[model samples]
Target: MTKPVRKAVFPVAGLGTRFLPATKTMAKEMLPVVDKPLIQYAVEEAAAAGIEYFIFVTGRGKHVLVEHFDHAFELEQLLGARGKTEALETLRAAIPAPGTVISTRQQNPLGLGHAVWCARAFIGEDEPFAVILPDDLILSDTPAIGQLIEAHAKVGGNVVATEDVPREHTNRYGILKVQSDDGRLARADGLVEKPKPEDAPSTLSIIGRYVLDATVMDRLGSIGKGSGGEIQLTDGMAATIDDGVPFHGLRFEGTRFDCGDKVGFLKANMAFALDRPDMRDDVAAFLKDMAAGL
Candidate 1:
């Protein structure tokens, strides 16, 4: 039987240099999309997908991310005193059950693979785990990770979320060498990290959501620095495919926002804000007026 993906690891150790001035004093994962932090959206997605354990691979100055999940005794008391029952309920609903959320230090800015490897001790052999890069926020009727988990149940191998990218943009993503395309699921024979458009095999670019077998940790164990001299998770994933393990690409149903980029962050703010019941009308009208001026 395939092991259920019970735990999800969040790679939140990045320095967020792009959003420097704001991130210089805070973790980027704490940056808000609409209202909730990026990390909160990732956690809620995992929890909704039946993920029981949340492992956050953090670094120095990431205490704020940890505190976000913890109880605010004074704040809760103040809300109670003010008869803000709805506010208190919202806060309580956002937090996971005690003992389910834990943080571990990554201590270095190695790369995505290294950050994931940092949490290997929390994942045991014979168990499958999920990794959510909080920077890639997805809005879908079914949470993106949940979509991958559902696909994992059918295929029973390492499953990654994939989406088509423009030929000119293939260099920005890890492209897949697909063996066959079966509608939503593509059987991949190989994965190449950021190949030039001319050298690319297909446009099925890998995204941030992944449901990986624990054996991926074993492959990552020996993966040296790749591409930009950082331990890339794509390198580790490719090793598993090379070893003859079944690899699948799930064309997940969602609108993904690359929140790590400035343009993408602004896009997410506008998109999510426009989706909110209270803000949609005003935001839409403002956007229309702004477009008219442009």
Candidate 2:
């Protein structure tokens, strides 16, 4: 029987070096897209997917990421006194219910594999879980991670979100070797971490969302450094495949923004703002006028 995926691990330990000065003190996941931070979007996606236990793998100075989900008593009191019902309600809505959120520290700047392994205790030995990278902000009618969760329920093994990128850009992602595919779902024979264009198996590249079995934690525990001399999560997942575990990739319906990039971050802000009913017209008009100027 397929156990429900109740927990999700969020690796928020990255030193957002790309965003430099702006991220010097702030967690990169804390960077805002429109009114909500990137991490908040990820949390909402996980929540929408029915994930109840949020396990955040944090680093030094990443306390704010956990705090973001906590209650702000002073702010709430002030909002209540000022009769800011809307803002207060919004803030209250964002807070996760007590005892549902938990966090663990990843002391070293290890890779994604290690970050995930840090949350092994939170995810027991036999339960399946999800790992969401806040860097990839996916906007979809149905939550992107929820799509993967549904696939996981059927596949009962492991499922990763996949998208086709240009062959030239294959080296930027974990490329999947498609054994068989039926349009939306592809059974992966293998996964390669950031393989060069000539070495890539297929153009279907793994994205930041994943619904994985707990056995992956066992693989991640003993897996050695791979690719760029870091403990790559792709390497661990590949090991699971080697262990005769089934792995599949889902071509989820979504528009993804690589929020780790400056251009992508700016584009996400514009896209999300345009998605709002209140801001859509004003943002659309501004964009049109700006385009006319260009």
Best by lDDT: 2
Candidate 2 residue-wise lDDT, 57-96, digit = tens: 9999999999999999999999999999999999999988
- Error (Å) of candidate 1 at residue 19 is 0.6
TM-score of each: 0.98, 0.99
Q: Top model by TM-score, which number?
A: 2
Record all residue pairs in model 2 with backbone atoms less than 3 Å apart, i.e. clashing: none
Tens-digit lDDT string for candidate 1 (110-131):
9899999999999998789999
lDDT of 1: 0.93
In candidate 2, stretches whose alpha carbon ends up further than 4 angstroms from where it belongs are none
